[model samples]
Target: MPILGLKAPGPSTPAHFSLEPLIRPNILALQPYRCARDDYSAGVLLDANENAIGPALPSASAKKVKVNGHSDSNGTSGASASAEDIALETLSLLPPGTDLNRYPSPTHDELKRRIAHLRGVPDENWVFLGVGSDEVIDMLFRVLCVPGKDRVLTTPPTYGMYKVTANVNDVGVLEVPLIAEGGKFQLDEDAMDEAFTANPDLKIVFICSPGNPTGTVIPLPAIRRVLENPKFKGVVLVDEAYIDFAPSNSSAAQLINEYANVCVTQTLSKSFGLAAIRLGYLLAPPPLIQILTNTKAPYNISVPTASIAASAVSDAGMAVMAEAVSTLNANRDYLLETLPTIPSIGDILGGNDANFVLVQVLDGPKGKVCNNRAVQVYKTMAETRGVVVRYRGGEIGCEGCLRITVGTRTECEEVIKQLKDLLA
Candidate 1:
């Protein structure tokens, strides 16, 4: 029987596959990032221009002392560092095995194993480890979106990276603002449906639960609605970076096996307390994993990052972190209940589920009051009371709002004290 006319043998037949058409034509023609050599054999290496005989980058110990205020040599601080300070400190440390002059592992296998075991996801389903969750978000746009031709949908007052990545990739962003009625924000299904209808070619839908800025979790039923829509054939990226902070468990990892179109991205930066390690993960179907791997830069994760991240995911580490998260949640609750008592604060976004809460400042007679006032308050609190919070406004709908990450119990009490003084 001719193969064209006959039904192929099921499972037993020899499989033949070609990736020529599946890859984007543009991506196939693009040149990837070229760094150091891939091989580590005993030989003089000088291909990539580097100071072969120079002093190495600053040690982690040195960097830690400069950045972290604590007396510990490991750079771990008793108090929280500002995000910018943390980023600067992390950049000071060189990649692992720098003195050995050998190339690190191309795939970060050990890290993957630890992550897989910790997350309960099979190793095969993850791909494209990057410096942060932002990198993965960028990669998702690069792999799935056609830029200008395709679009992605996100609810505003969410993580700004989804929009920023879309803009950087030259992809169109279709935003549907979440409903902030009755002093609580939730996913607006009607707006989502309308946006999807308007943009049929949307290749990705970015949903951050216990959403950024808003700190609202998209309801499970609402998520199911989006996934079940036949019109949504493209990938649905659910960013669970802050999910560990939420009261409820994450839906992204749990729904992965059920929905082929769903892909969940997470980060160690948030809950794992390994923000300096620059590790994030994606949980998707094997096919999507293959596509992401094919498109991602080779050796995207460095050895030190992989090593520390894997260590951070241990059972004991997770237990300690869980306690920390609980403490933060309690702190968040304290702030939520207490902030409203002071005047000038309007509707709050996110409720019990988030690690942070969004406080909307009511504008006075001055034309569209400045939200930076909250930042000013934050700065004063940081300097006087040693408490720091994020100011997130200046977006379309986030006017006069401040994003406050929950701190330790004592730190939170200090914050409350400072805010009370400011309000008074």
Candidate 2:
């Protein structure tokens, strides 16, 4: 199979880097399922078995409001409504022309175009959308790795999904631990090179930048080493799910044009506050993007999702997201400054580049990091104390650590207050 077999339009891809050879044979020859929307989305009398009489919901104007403890068709009140009325109110949020009966566009190019522009990609061809980053992860595995044969290398204490998805696909995972010394949590380049040499058959290398639990960004130079490695020919997956909170110029999306084997995954779940919409996208060279696009479900993204994502990546949406990220970053800073002041809190680990802080929970004011204490505090906060945070005391280099997401000022203060009382 040749990379040229797929007519992907973009800048000149690396001549030495061919995607087909690394892809599963069956996938290379797959005939993508063509949907009706792919052909025409215009005036349709009878196409794709769509209901001509519109969707099964009342008109948006039919929504009612309760006023003075009486049912009114207009105006607002504090009273709750029946299930039907609630459904109507939710449906009203959709555009007046949303056709739920019809299938969504297989290639929502406009949405992709906006996302491409936001991510600094060449064009929509360089992007692929999935239900979430989880789907993007699964699709990469589906297209590249052969079940029970090929393997992927992941950094420990990283996003669990990379390993989980690998396991779900019957693929083996190779662990190369990140450098935990000095709370750096960075990629150990030499160890990764050794793994590549030891496992030449590995199909993908998953690196979670602004890493989960660690919240540290793997600098671009470190990533370049892996990409330029002579021992590995597989794709280098950079999961930037938390990239929004990291410092500027910290993304691997910039490397796609330079390296054909690099793929970057991002989601609207975090910064955009659109997790319910379940939109995630991947940025890569056209060849790999095209293959993953062809392998995904024809209508994996719904019309509502596309609409929501379009608004999210729009200029106004970007402004709103930027403001939110700024606030969260400030909150994260507050945690970094305040967590260490608590009596039993030890050194806060990682770079704190993400929206969370990973801090060690000590047994007493001067005691060592204690897993039992961390677990007790975590359980107490969630179950009895009405506050919640993750206990990552079991992860590599994160013993007796609690991964706390940066929250609003009040929430951040409350957590600090709770920790002080509990540790006291």
Global lDDT of each candidate: 0.66, 0.86
* Runs of candidate 2 exceeding 4 Å displacement: 3-5, 9-16, 58-92
> lDDT per residue, candidate 2, 129-167, as tens digits?
999999999999999999989999999988888888998
Candidate 2, overall lDDT?
A: 0.86
TM-score of each: 0.76, 0.92
lDDT per residue as tens, model 1, 152-174:
88877678778788888898888
**lDDT assessment of candidate 1:** 0.66
Best by lDDT: 2
Worst 10 residues of 1 by lDDT: 5-14
lDDT of 1 at 419: 71
